[model samples]
Target: MITRTQLVGAWSLESYTETDVQSGEVSYPMGRHPEGLILYTFDGYMSAQLGSGRRDRFKGQDPYGASSEEYTAAGRSYIAYSGPFYFDESNGRLEHEMFVSFFPNWQGQRQVRIAAIDDDRLHLGPDRPMPFNGRLKTASLIWKRALPNS
Candidate 1:
């Protein structure tokens, strides 16, 4: 079991990769360079925000006034969720219960993640196969502890 000291904090995204089950091929679902944050709090709450590196900006500054194409583009590249989390001490599995999600289907969803930390890196995933586009692939995400004020 990982100590709370090592697990609770703001972590910055380093890489997000998915490996295909049948072909054993690796891919980056959020473009080659993705950016994001995953936060674990002492109060058992967790939040995640992930985005592709290449996101297009809308022509209009007003979000509510954005065109359908702009709205769709943004939604396709970003994923966000927040909710309570339970980390099992005996099994070392982390369960994230999504109270809110940008993806409507994920609201009230519970996902079990395989989590591990070594040195300054935290590895998370294989939380069942993640569907990207139309294909399902096992995701492997790497995160590094966010330095203070960074």
Candidate 2:
């Protein structure tokens, strides 16, 4: 049986490879980045920092036709959200009740995550529906155990 104690620690994302359902292509957005970290403690404290990549064309362009800038806001590119988190051993699930979010719109929301723990990696997938481009899609995340003192 999986227990919460087994998941208590700081983990860094080793790779984030996803397949675009529409195009059937694989993409690795978070590869070899130290800025990604997920912490789960026994005291019910949880924090997650997801690194951001280059913005897509539409995301970086301004409606007013302003010159696009590269790496100007890249340094601040990261998704950070933290709050109280709970673990349900019966179903092997982790729920994150978000208090603060970098997106500002996700504040005060509970994100249910279905977690799968293995010998060296932990795969977390969203249990709730995620709206993408006005459509609901499933979002999955993976984290590898960070060696102690590494």
Candidate 3:
């Protein structure tokens, strides 16, 4: 049983893999080498941001001034959300009670993940396949603890 205390800190993304429920086709949601950060605070708040490793730069320097194509590209390649989080140590479950998210539909959602920690790495995944793109797929994400200076 992993305690909340053991999870308070920043973790760097190692991988994000998805498996199609029907076809068993495994794919990378954020490319072969994605980038992300998941942070947990002692205050019980958590946030996560994951993105494709290679994102094209917007034509304009100002973020708000990017072209529609750039905005679409950016939107398609990133996922972010934050909210209060809790751990059910006995069940090995982590819950994210999302207050907000990049996908508006997920706001106010209670996302549950089965989690395990080995060495400095954290593995998280849903118990069953959830919707992605337009189908059901199970996703497993791996994260590694950040170094003190990282």
Task: Give me the candidate number with maximum TM-score.
Answer: 3
Tens-digit lDDT track of model 3 for 1-150: 788888899999999999999999999988999999999999999999999999999987898999899999999999999999988777778998789899999999998888888989999888788999888999999999989883
Clashes of each: 0, 0, 0
Best by lDDT: 3
Residue 56 in candidate 3, Cα distance off native in Å: 0.6
Candidates ranked by lDDT = 3, 1, 2
Superior by lDDT: candidate 1 or candidate 2: 1
Against the unseen true structure, what C-alpha lDDT does each candidate score? 0.90, 0.71, 0.92
lDDT of 2 by residue, 130-149 (tens): 65434455556778988898
The TM-score that candidate 2 achieves is: 0.73
lDDT, candidate 2, equals 0.71
RMSD over all Cα atoms, model 1:
1.4
What is candidate 1's local distance difference test score? 0.90
- RMSD per prediction, one decimal? 1.4, 5.9, 1.1
How do the predictions measure up, each by TM-score? 0.94, 0.73, 0.96
